[model samples]
Target: MAQKQNTLRVGLVGAGIGGLAAAIAIARAGADVTVLEAAQELGEIGAGIQMTPNAARLLRAWGVDKVIGDNLVRFEELNLRRKDGTKVGGGPTIRVEKTLGQPWWLVHRAHLHEGLVDVARKNGCDIHIDSRVASISYQTPGPVQVQTERGATFSFDLLIGSDGVGSIVRRTLFPSVKPSPPTTNCAYRAVVPYSQIRKDPSLVELVSKPTMEVWMAPHAYIITYPISAGKDFNMVLSHHRPNPVIAVEDVDMNDFRNDYRDFDPRIRKIIDMVPTAKRWPLLVTGPLDTWSSPQKNVVLMGDAAHSMVNHMAQGAATAMEDGAFLGRVLRETVSGRLSLAEAITIYEKSRMPKAYFKQQVSFLNGYIWHLPEGQAAINRDKAMEVELKGEQPMRTPNLYVDPTTVLEVYGYDAEADADEAIRSFLEQHESKDESTGITKKEADKILNWFLPEEERFLIPSKF
Candidate 1:
């Protein structure tokens, strides 16, 4: 019989959102899990993150919502408008909650990070700070070893790379892969105290209720919403340029103000009040040919696997989904029901399609939001108006900002999908094996789902 999965020792690189969440998830699956972080302190930046119902449901199930506290602001709508504040189009977020059974939440990044960290500790996950992973070496059919910058080595049954876009783990596994530069856009982010906003009547009206205010223009857009229980307002101004003259990190307040000179005066006032801002260059990576190491004992998760432009705001949520589903797969492996290799295979098949689909849509969203002045942009606005107002017949579809589109994306449950994948895996293998379990052919079929026809010949014949 295979060893019980609870006996598995797992090591995770990076203690960011994805790693911490995965640590809690792996621990819950009855494994001994350790998270290594290069950062000296476990803290999140002061930016904001949106947690749609799909992700919020998982966090609630993991008991993270309670610790997230009342500081979370729940919203019922995402309003899209012109730079002049003219309503263009948007969807009712409450309708999503009604359909999906969980409310959408907006939160400060630090708050969400804190909640995950607290729950991870409660679940008995050993998180080591400042332990930078230098390299990973795996002896197939044996344990995987991780070397840290401090010259210490740790052995584990499996390794997970959650180390953001610039993942050393990913680099060690596939040295040839390189992430693309900024995709013609950068975001300037800032948070303003609600006190300052409330003093201005226009800003007060905007924040009187929980809403996602999106202002779209020809070559730019702005997203603003309340976070930290309305204690502060989060703003992200995204601009598109064919040839960006300055690095995103070097963008200053003057540059930010200049970009939005034509925006609504009221909105500009909010920008002026922001003491400082951080600029982030939007980055993306093409879908990988494979997400696991050659031994299949190590896997990449979150941004390391699919670092997408944040046009759709699915970056963090998708990372959470990856952790949740991985937890489920590990649970099955820990129970001695499946081999580690088989479990990771199922995890990849179950996750890659969904994640890649999200990445594609996220890229498309950037195009839609920053459409240049043309007939296409006008038609897009008209379609959104029709959808938002419930006017006219079913007509053409607005794939970008419609409520149905939102529902289709946020309605997914990663845990549920994982359960289905496991069932399929068992059925496929059990049917193929007379008494000796999966045959080489059956195992290859299960493992080579994403490989090309010519490349599928490489899987070894032995188990």
Candidate 2:
């Protein structure tokens, strides 16, 4: 396929979900997209990921949803319980779908990655595996250049750093920025096959139908949901790290069992069923002061931009939103209506506040979910109980049912937000037409560049 006229040559580092999502969105917007992956092969190593409505909307738009098809499980509800199986709060998620026009989904991370890879390739993205970026050059009057470890060099008009938490691209952009200190929390992840869950009567309720179950207690919480179309049950247990060293390692089964031994009996049963589990020390990077370089040619996305605590489970979703918004804004550059610098600035301006908000909220949620057995915990439970009993619609401790948070997080539309930002940019620049040379007619055209509503949600046939 021929490249679109005046389209950007985008070199994106990282082929993880965020990178691939950006590649797909950019390629779909008629840019030449090349993705560089450090790994020897393409795949995700994690167990499960929650696809909130915000992320799910982008997946459907990119035609990735169909590619993910049966691998996804659309969960009906979220159940929030005390550590000892006492119900606290959480309600059906069906209303989220109704309110947002997108369903909340759960899927194996590998399946989601595969689907994104397939859709990205179908959309004409070039993905190079085993192509670790060794260095990047940001020359003022020339294209940004990237050198791979294997001695191959690639050049592009724009460079996106989606390389994750330890992003080399990010370091090159802001070398003066210091690394964030590791948090005290660590997470243990495991998957129990649905067959195993079904064999035991005590665990059958977990897989009988799809639901997200969260058991919260002082200094710890465990979240479980069905994945791989309900063929497996995925669990994440977050707790205080016994060892101060921050790393991902195998946890001894006995130690893992002992950690949650005092919790619900059914949880202990699930823990006993697991053969092994991996403990990952939770780490956070910037809610950085800036995500783009001084030149505006190099920018960061996803975890590279802001890797926060996983309490809100919006890390990947926000990254996907970044991809969607970048794609939308860059279309102006592709159409010659906005300069590369202008588009990048608009993207940073539009996305950073919300991304920062999410980062803080995720951190706040960590504190809320792991409250100790005290007056604060009691108050939280009472607020959640009131919401659960339909007594009030005010903000509650339960994020799933928190009206303001749910609307702000799940009902977000990246493309729509981008359009609004672009309009704002045009309006602001148009006021200085004598200096900027942006005529009213040109601004109007740019304002109306969005796709028709009828065609907006249509997936590509190839997908």
Candidate 3:
């Protein structure tokens, strides 16, 4: 397969962080990109998010660092304390910069989303608000048809599903797969303005540092950090619900206070000062069998492919990686260096391992963060103390003692990994082929082999 002279049209469903990032990345690579968002207006919807070095590197490379830099707060450490403010675990995170060559930053979700949207538009991506994708149809040897809610249909060379955990594209692909019910875990998020909290002396101490503060408790934990240039505090409290499944969207001050009644007094006041809070019913999707279509022109990225536990704060970071990595693959495809199948296969192979690995780690992190009263929990605190006292290596027999673990996750380079994957795929296939490289037909056959039988449906049209 050689480069096509015509510009590639890419249609992205969902204009969340992943979709916006993908639009920018694809547009930067000279593809005509359009993003369909179901919302009436695109704005920030979440409280806060951490952008690790791995994700920041991609944002900087995409030339939107400045757009998101204004309200960013650089955190130098991650401090873990008990519910009552007793120091227990975590360590200085400045080493993340040393190991990964980039700094850790926190920003309000709205700021980051706005910046990404602006950058994507500046990159010439057509962002269509209120355009909800109703269905997608594959057309072999031609464009894929994307029908939206408004009874309009558009065709593109590729279709990307960057929608969140409840993804229509994913459902369309695996119609038999139902969304998993909510888990026992539930999270409450609130942002306390520094101007309002500064009046309280007890809360002043909490906001004194740029560190990511984690307060561990029995069957619950709270993570708080500064964002909006340290003008506001981003707080997240994750705890087990009494019921197996509970959906709490509206905020209730009394409920929040009751949940963390035993928490630090300062944190209690911080909770009291919050005007409102949003509750998130933590749900986990079963591991997806596949994230791409048989033809590879249509794919799922971000939460649509692999939604994980948020304990590791890698939700947004992993989504960014998805978009960044896919961008790299599409760039090569646009350049005629590889067929769509080969490029997408390489992307899927390289990204699935990292995404799923993080997903598992995130679940483990939640377990460790919210350990109930037991010898195991006591041992964890003891291990953290030992690591902090320099009496033991960071790799103590506890999840909370390791700083290198953070470095490992935050140091991954999506573009480099994708490039390496492409090289390996080329070498392996070229060796098997008698021609200069794998033909388009050969690439499709390899792709089809990896697809499930259900996905082997024929496209009645030339794609």
Candidate 4:
């Protein structure tokens, strides 16, 4: 008789955009999910989050695209400009309305979380808003043990640390490594009133137009993208190092404006018009050696795995991608005859390389904002010129979407993908058996080829 599969239970820490999204996807897959939020209340007071088409495509597949569509400012083009206001070169969006099957939107962070929270609740996820995760236990092959600040304890079959870069789950799993050290790069984020920029026709034109605009300077760059249905502009002004940390409690422009030196007068005017501005230091985090820990059950996702420079404006998008991928992998394991440990190996083996590639890309693209002696600036302009000509030299899509094309992505059919991964594995194994009697070591080498070249380095050669 077929052994009845255990009901997969999941515990997710941090109910930020990524955690909430994970809860919704996992619950929808009929897996039990419980999400814990440290904050007493869920709120997003910061500026805008840029969710590109690759992330949007996955959101659409999960059935929340309508919620995303309701809060979109579909950009028809993306314009790049120099400090003197000369056009560096801009191009039509590959993800404009009707292009990638859905319109990409930039909504306020809090609102997006609210939508996902509702979806999670409706899909049967247990969400506790006021609870804080104090610690985690990962010493066994069972569910991770979570202790909340309020002394509440819970356990589940899978633990996902979707928390921000300073994840407690990460620390518990890998205690020796220093947590993502705070960086010297600080960001002053704000959302200005539309009427303030709307009065100026030229500024209004840029803000009103359906596009993401970047004004690059010697040491800094300002990214302004439309959100709130084109009525509001979400602006993120960032620069290079040694910046002191800013308090998150309130908006203080006095200290924040120090970074905006020599910016355009209009840009200054918009900055002056913002009612609230909060600053935070930017940090980059890489993949940990043990994503699944000694327990072999808990996994970290989103910023907990790879935190990149904000240059790509993909902090949230990457997290959403993590949630979607996790759901797909778990669904396959439940349906395939594989054990949870085997499924998680497949998950880490599949996702780590993709996440690592994105981290590297973010690091590379970050320099485009600051070009010493204009060398990097020249490369930027050249690429833009090529793009404007309706051509691209490297086939690099905006946001560099090479990670989404993995077999895990194309083969993701919920349960079917697991069946297929297994089917493909067995078929090849059988063929080998019929031919020359392949060893277990040979079988693993063939199966692991599906993982990226970087992660393929993880398996020690046993043959």
Which candidate ranks first by lDDT, i.e. highest? 2
What's each prediction's TM-score? 0.89, 0.91, 0.89, 0.83
Clashes of 1: 1
Q: Model 3: which ten-residue window has the lowest total lDDT?
A: 454-463
RMSD of each: 7.5, 7.9, 8.4, 7.5
Candidate with the greatest TM-score versus the true structure: 2
lDDT of 4 by residue, 1-463 (tens): 1233658889999898888877877776667899988889876557678666656665666666566556755677777777655666666665343434544567777667667776777788898878888878778555678899899999888889988778888777766655342445556677876767888775756665677777777767788877776667788877655554533334456756767756666677777777767666666666667587755688888888777667766677777767876776666555655556665676676567766766666655556565554566676676666655665444332332222332122223333333455455445444333344665456567755686665543344433
TM-score of 2: 0.91
Candidate 3 total steric clashes: 6
Q: Write the per-residue lDDT of candidate 3 for residues 223-246, one digit (tens) a residue.
A: 999898888889998977766543
Better of 1 and 3 by lDDT: 1
lDDT accuracy of residue 167 in candidate 1: 90
Q: Candidate 4: where are CA atoms >4 Å away?
A: 1-3, 94-102, 140-142, 179-183, 243-252, 386-463
Candidate 2 residue lDDT tens string, 1-463: 1133466899999999999999998998889999999999999997999999999999898889899999888987787888998888877888768878898999999999999999999989999999999999995678998999999999999999999888899889988654453567878999998887788888766667888999999999999998997888899999887554356788788998888988889887888999988887666777688998888899999989888788888989999999999999888888877888888999999899989899888888888889999999999888888646645357888876687888898889999999999988887675424555656565446542575655432223313
Candidate 1 lDDT by residue in tens digits, 304-420: 998887887888889899999889989988899888888889888878888889988887887887887889888878777765674432432344235556666788888888899
Report residue 340 deviation for candidate 1 (angstroms).
Answer: 0.4
Per-prediction tally of clashes: 1, 0, 6, 0
After TM-score superposition, the amount by which residue 315's alpha carbon in candidate 2 deviates from its true location, in angstroms, is 0.9
Instruction: Find the number of clashing residue pairs for candidate 4.
Output: 0
